[model samples]
Target chain A: MTRYKAVIQYDGSDFLGYQIQATGRTVQEEIQKALTKMHKGQKTVVNASGRTDTGVHAKGQVIHWDSPFSIPVEGYYRGLETLTPDDIAIVSVEEVAADFHARYDVSGKEYRYFVKRSPQHDPFSRHYALRYPFDLDESLMNQAARILEGEHDFTSFCSARTDRESKVRNLYAIKIMPTEDGWIFSFSGSGFLYNMVRILVGALLYVGQKKLTPAEIKVALDKKDRTALVSRTAPPQALYLWEVFYEKDNKK
Target chain B: MTRYKAVIQYDGSDFLGYQIQATGRTVQEEIQKALTKMHKGQKTVVNASGRTDTGVHAKGQVIHWDSPFSIPVEGYYRGLETLTPDDIAIVSVEEVAADFHARYDVSGKEYRYFVKRSPQHDPFSRHYALRYPFDLDESLMNQAARILEGEHDFTSFCSARTDRESKVRNLYAIKIMPTEDGWIFSFSGSGFLYNMVRILVGALLYVGQKKLTPAEIKVALDKKDRTALVSRTAPPQALYLWEVFYEKDNKK
Candidate 1:
């Protein structure tokens, strides 16, 4: 069996998430279904870089799967185009090492969260941005974002349902940019917990509204307690998994 | 009774068109419904600058409505917010003279048509731009567009369903801009016939594909024959009623 890695882009509007669930269509199920069809009815399991919550879009999601029969990398791209749904596209496919793993080999990730501050109804922007009528102060939000970089116990910024052994993660950088409709908060990190990026963005948004100060965010991080956080989790529609990075030299 | 001239913006996805049809929701119908609710069972009629085809969006569509009540202009803005649907917005409203008309008194109109050439899936741009898979030659299209400017018989570039007395119209400018994903063609003119803009854009796209020449477009205009045109009509979703211009002194 040959292993192949594929880069994916999808609109998460109708997807439950990246993982399998009891009900609702998911990104994972759709890709696996397509693979099974291409493999002549034999089931094929695919692994992804990470799981994105419902309504979260992706541009450069990475996945790897073993093919039951040998096929050219270009064959996958040409074949999947006819099989995948309108909202999903196979960006690129490449032959990978037999032991390559999509999820375990990931080294870093980048995510973007868009917020539309304008009250005007822009039908086009509504699909990609979370519209917030409440005013936001950019300087305060930027200050809070800067303080979020580096290793920290992100327990306060993760979903309460998470039960990881350790809540520590390394954040490489955070960039806040003012867009035409509103602002986009970009996060690059070694790893993120469940709902971690959304929670981190929500906290900065609170700072922008002047409800919480930069010092308050620092204190919340030091406490490492979810209950001590003042920011509510942001919605899922505006969040996007921009890219997933993997080390080339770390071949299995 | 007080006459109010309102600037409107609406998404045309759920709308049949700007005109009242036998069934299905229209932009005019939605605004009229909102007004009827504000007037407490009093049916309201709104006259618009012009009608847009089904699935055509608008940003600065002007309309005039005579109200049974003499309400404050500011109050109308606040009141209409709750009455209007999520996809529609009353951008501005002001009291106008009783003699002022939205349709006949118009000076000029600006229409924007977007064409997305890339095949990649961008969920955000999908709502506003029409996707075209074939390659387009920018210079050939621009040359054809320049020849289309000036007063001429536009019968070949109008919907055959139209029954206007005169087909002669003056075009002020035609600007073709290449965007990141594709191209946007902007047209400014004294007035446009039924489906004139879309038909004109369709002809230009054919030129970009090397199916026709700029000289052939001029010949089609000279013939004033609808059957002389070879390009197919463009879709409505990519067409936007950008703005309506009026004399500054014509204010009511």
Candidate 2:
């Protein structure tokens, strides 16, 4: 048996999420369906580094699966390129060690939340970026983001649906950069909980609006209460899984 | 009656063209429909600066219509904004002089043709840019573009379907600029004939590919024959009506 790793990109606009569900479409289902068709009637499974919510995009998602048949890597790519949906594409593929597992080997992750502050609705880019039609103080937003730059129990930022026992996670970096189009909030961390990045963005937006002080973020984290957040969770459309890092020599 | 002028933007991916047809939806049809709805079934006619082909986008298209009811400019804008299609939007509106005309008062126009040279199709921007998977010599393309930068009878470049009496037009400027994602060919001219810009872009692409010499562009213009061109017309989706200039004071 040969284990193969794949780098993937997806629009995620029409997908339910990264994982499979009883109803609605998913990125995992599309890949598994393509692999199943490639292997005739045999079942094929793939494990991804993480999951992304509906309407969230990804440019560098990683996944691994053991092939039932030892076909050439090019052959596998050709089959996937022909069978996969238009919105989903495999950018590159490589053969990996038999013991290698995508989710278990993942070391870190990076995510970005895009925003456009405009008084009028931008119909063209509405699907890709959040349009906030109000003024936001950039200095306050930055100060609030600085408070989240270390390890903490991120229970207040995570959604209630997450059943993970440990809420502790380390955030390596967080910053807000202005782009020609708008602003982008970048986050890199060891791991993220369900909607953790989105909720954190929501809190930063409130700080920018002057509705919440930067000190409140520390209180929310210390109290371990989700409702302590001053703002609602940000929408999924503006969120993107930028990259996934793994241990060992990270080639291909 | 107040003469109202509107500067508009549209995606044009699903539009047939800017002109009304016997069947199929046009930008004009949508605007007219919105105006009719605003006027309680009263017929409203709008005059556009120029007609764009199927799937051609516009960042700043100008149009004028005489309002049936004397309403404030904001009122007209509000009604159109609420009734217009999602793909089409008015950026700004103003009340113009009584003698103002959208088409007849036009002095010049600026068009932009976007090109992406890539081996793979970009599904994200595929609807807006033309993808040509070939190496293009920008120097050669610029040389070819320079030869057509003056007043000339563009009989060879104009489509055969055009019935304009005089084929003479002044091309004030033509230059190719590189973008972060792709290349853009900008053309600012006093006037353009039907399919003139697309056909010019086609010939420039051939010149860039070394299939045709840059000097041959001058020959085609001198020949004044439609069939003398070396390349096919570029697609309409990649073309954009960037700006329109009106004579004296430049108002409606």
- The top-ranked prediction according to TM-score is 1
| DockQ (CA atoms), all models | 0.38, 0.31
Candidate 2 collision pairs? none
Please list the residue runs of candidate 2 whose C-alpha ends up more than 4 Å from where it truly belongs after superposition: A14-26, A29-44, A74-86, A163-166, A248-252, B20-26, B40-43, B117-121, B160-166, B248-252
| Model 2 chain B: ten consecutive residues of lowest lDDT | B118-127
Q: Per-residue lDDT for A1-252 in model 1, tens only?
A: 889999998888779988878898998998899999999999999899999888899988999999878888889998876788877888989988888888998999999998988866666555578888888898888888778899999988898899997999999999988877688889999999999998998898889889999999999988988988978998898899999998865333
Candidate 1 share of real interface contacts: 0.28
lDDT of 1: 0.88
Q: TM-scores of all models?
A: 0.90, 0.88
DockQ of 2: 0.31
Q: Which runs in model 1 stand beyond 4 Å of their true positions? A: A20-25, A41-43, A117-119, A132-139, A248-252, B21-25, B117-121, B132-135, B248-250
Worst 10 residues of 1 chain B by lDDT: B118-127
lDDT of 2 by residue, B151-223 (tens): 9999999998999999999999998998876689999999999999999999999998898888888899899
